[model samples]
Target: MPPRRCTASAAAGQTGSDSDLDEFIMRCLSCEEQYDMDDAGTCRECYQEANEAEEELRLEIDDLKSKVSFLTLSSPTLNPSTADIVLVPVDDSDAAPIPAHKHVLSCRSPVFNAMLENDMEERRSGTIKISDVSHDTLCAFVNYLYTAEASLDNQMACNLLVLGEKYQVKHLKTYCEKYLIAKMNWNKAIANYAFAYQYNCKQLRSASLAVILDKMDLFTQNEYYAELVDTNPRLVVEIYETYIGKQLNTAGTL
Candidate 1:
């Protein structure tokens, strides 16, 4: 908000003595209250403008939310009679197949588009086998494809992000990335950094790196960091390289 207070000292330069009583007071442009200009936050115009913009944004958000609800596909039912294809979790033989429409999958992911359109084994057999994911995670992933919504948590966010990365679902990947970034702390930063780097989640990687750098000592003591060093020494080295660079810049500033 613009400061509510302004002084007539501004007018003194135009025509009055410096010590003049009339020159010492001025009315605020916004509240019309007279105050000294030297004090901080002496006006309220910026606050009013910000409030108006916020209200406009809220109205737009309501419209967008309604459109989303209208466009979202209905949640999958227990019956798969109408479904065109089934997704099988290869790791779980006893797992029930997740029924879905080929068209919806194709529209959502280019990878799925290629698989469904071409003479792939999945197209021939009508069974799309997914690997390294649990039945529950697969169901949640399919649901998000149909309706851009998911009940996310730390593990779920990480699981879905991997699937999203594999399928090249940019929106889902970004969604998961944001969730992970929001949940990240020093304790999880190293693992998140490795995961983000592996998946090419640039924004999440940056956030994780920032957290890790802030607590480098704690990162070195973390068991996950030790495991990461054993499994991917190069990524661990990259962290130190970045940290050293940041240190050098700080020293230069000093």
Candidate 2:
């Protein structure tokens, strides 16, 4: 061929074809990814609504954060003098006592409230002896009562959950239970189920039991299973009962 002719023509300075003009590509306002008409995410009105909703949620979250900050008390470690009562860990008596406000404790836990409000020995002595809890656990429990927060690892969460349950601190119990549930896996499932049953934590117990049921084939091989069967045969029976019930339900569904 001698000289090739331009098969596609363009108007004035324009170089793109008619197909490009009609392609209708636009970036998603929410996700900020480019999309064509076929993959269009939302209309302008819906996008604006979504943005407004997101902003409102952000403002609400900020407000809640500020409120939490305002409500949170200063740590007893930082200002021990302001505390009206002291909590001594009976299990770890050598450890330094944990100081706390009576009002704060009373507000957070019914057990504390009853102990402090009435003419109890704890109120008279201005000291409460907490048994079977380590110094670290007592500190964490007191800190959570003050701030409604805790930095939780598995052991710490379990410790605090036990304290929370005994003291009737519902919020702390729920928090720790949720944390344990989030960290639940096959390795921890059996132990967590037993712990949850012991603590009366329904959510955690159910989740852990589900995990255990899913891996029932390996149940007998688990190290903790032998101990659990030896110590709490009733709990093991309950597990078998639950598994049977689930199987029956599944068969019914089928």
Candidate 3:
């Protein structure tokens, strides 16, 4: 919730006598009703400017997305003759290596650049092995490397997020974070918070914490709550401590 703010009209009369404050009737831009000046969320000007700024930001994002789309290259795998290396996902059963260009992979991920540019086995054998990820996930990752696009589900998003973090692909990690944040809710709050914290996703962690604070009474009812407590009691303690601290802050404010 936003803090109460007075309109410019209220401040205009502040230079005069204190009694002039009451003469300025508070008007809500949205509801158009008389509200106490001390009980307003925003003035009309601030609200309108915020809306305009949001729209401008949205347009800029769209423009950047368009430029990314324009710059997206056709996968070199489509022309295997042009591909210089293959990616092997060791987690899958006899998974086929996915073809990719070494330069593309190197450009997209610093980890890949280090592996391929140095005198590593991957540089010699022309095959890069990725572990702890299934072939499908690896395929999705490679496709995104080439296309700057991915069709994400919860599982895919989680998998990609891990790979993104490991490989230092900040863009892909942010993309996964946005998906996970959008899908987040009370039922998934605790697990999401734990995952976000582990992955150092500040935005997702804050969003999940907000949800948890809203439904603290229902926290224990979630099945994941017990699992989290059993697996990482420290994290559970941290959450409780955070909640208690916020409660203390609220008490102080009141």
Count of backbone clashes, every candidate in sequence:
9, 0, 0
Q: Among these predicted structures, which one has the highest TM-score? A: 2
Q: After superposition, how far is residue 109 of candidate 3 from its true place, in Å?
A: 0.8
> What's each prediction's TM-score?
0.82, 0.85, 0.76
Report lDDT (CA) for all predictions. Answer: 0.87, 0.88, 0.88
Candidate 2's TM-score reads 0.85
> Which has the higher TM-score value, candidate number 1 or candidate number 2?
2
The C-alpha local distance difference test score for the whole of candidate 2 amounts to 0.88
Ranking by TM-score: 2, 1, 3
Q: Local error of candidate 3 at 159, Å?
A: 0.5
Clashing residue pairs, backbone N/CA/C < 3 A, model 2: none
lDDT digits (tens) for residues 211-243 of candidate 2? 989998898887789989988999999998998
lDDT of 3 by residue, 169-234 (tens): 999999999999999989889999899889888988999989998999988898799999998999
lDDT of 1 by residue, 1-254 (tens): 33323355554456545555445565665565766656436235775787789999999999999999999987564556789889999998899999999999999999999999999999989989999999999999999998999999999999999999999999999999999998988888889988998999999999999988888878779768889999899999999999899899999999
- Model 3 / residue 227 / CA error / Å: 0.6
- Candidate 3 TM-score to native: 0.76
Worst 10 residues of 1 by lDDT: 1-10
Error of 2 at 13 (Å): 28
Q: Which lDDT value does model 1 have at 179?
A: 95
